[model samples]
Target: MDFKNEKQGAFMVVVPAGRMDAVTAPEFEQECERLIQSGELKMVADMSALEYISSAGLRSILATAKKLKGQQGEIRFCGLEGMVEEVFSISGFSSMFPVFDTRDDAIKD
Candidate 1:
């Protein structure tokens, strides 16, 4: 998996592409940690280019969410599709976090 991060208003928009599996999950988590450590609390995960995600990926996301929440921060997800969307739904992540159909919608609020 690859990540592209950018600041959008009050949120840090993280765009992840490719597959997020066991090997890449740790990297993803680390990147989020770095952002948080840098005082970036609000985050938006734009998964439009993500092709796949495994259970490990979900775990990483959950861990990041919990960490941010502990700091009174927030994380939202957007642009999920295909198997990625199915995985989130099946894993109950779709309800756990705020999900938007577009990056604009995710950042609007």
Candidate 2:
């Protein structure tokens, strides 16, 4: 996966492109860690360009979400479609994290 970073007001957005599967999940995790370490805990993961995801990808996101929660921070995801949305729903994660249809919605949350 490729990640493009953007800053909008107080939020940091990470726009990821490509498949966020087992092979690329670590990169996502690393980016999250970097954000957290930098004290930019409010994160918006713009997944509009993402085409695929695996269990490992979900796990990585969950871990990052939990970590941010502990810091009293928030994380939101946006622009999921196709199998990516299915995986989140089937895993019961759709209700666990805040997801939005657009990056603007996610950032607003």
Highest lDDT model number:
1
Clash counts per candidate, in order, are: 0, 0
Lowest summed lDDT window (length 10), candidate 2: 100-109
Runs with alpha carbons beyond 4 Å of true place in candidate 2: none
Q: What lDDT would each prediction earn against the true structure?
A: 0.94, 0.88
Which 10 residues in a row give candidate 1 its minimum summed lDDT?
1-10
Q: Considering every candidate listed, which one attains the maximal TM-score? A: 1
Query: lDDT for model 1, on a 0 to 1 scale?
Result: 0.94
lDDT of 1 by residue, 3-96 (tens): 8998999999999889899999898999999999999999999998889999999999999999999999999999999999999999999999
TM-score of 2: 0.93
Instruction: Give the per-residue lDDT digits (tens) of candidate 2, residues 1-109.
Output: 7889999877899987899889899999999999999999999888778899888999899999999999999898888888888988899888998889888777774
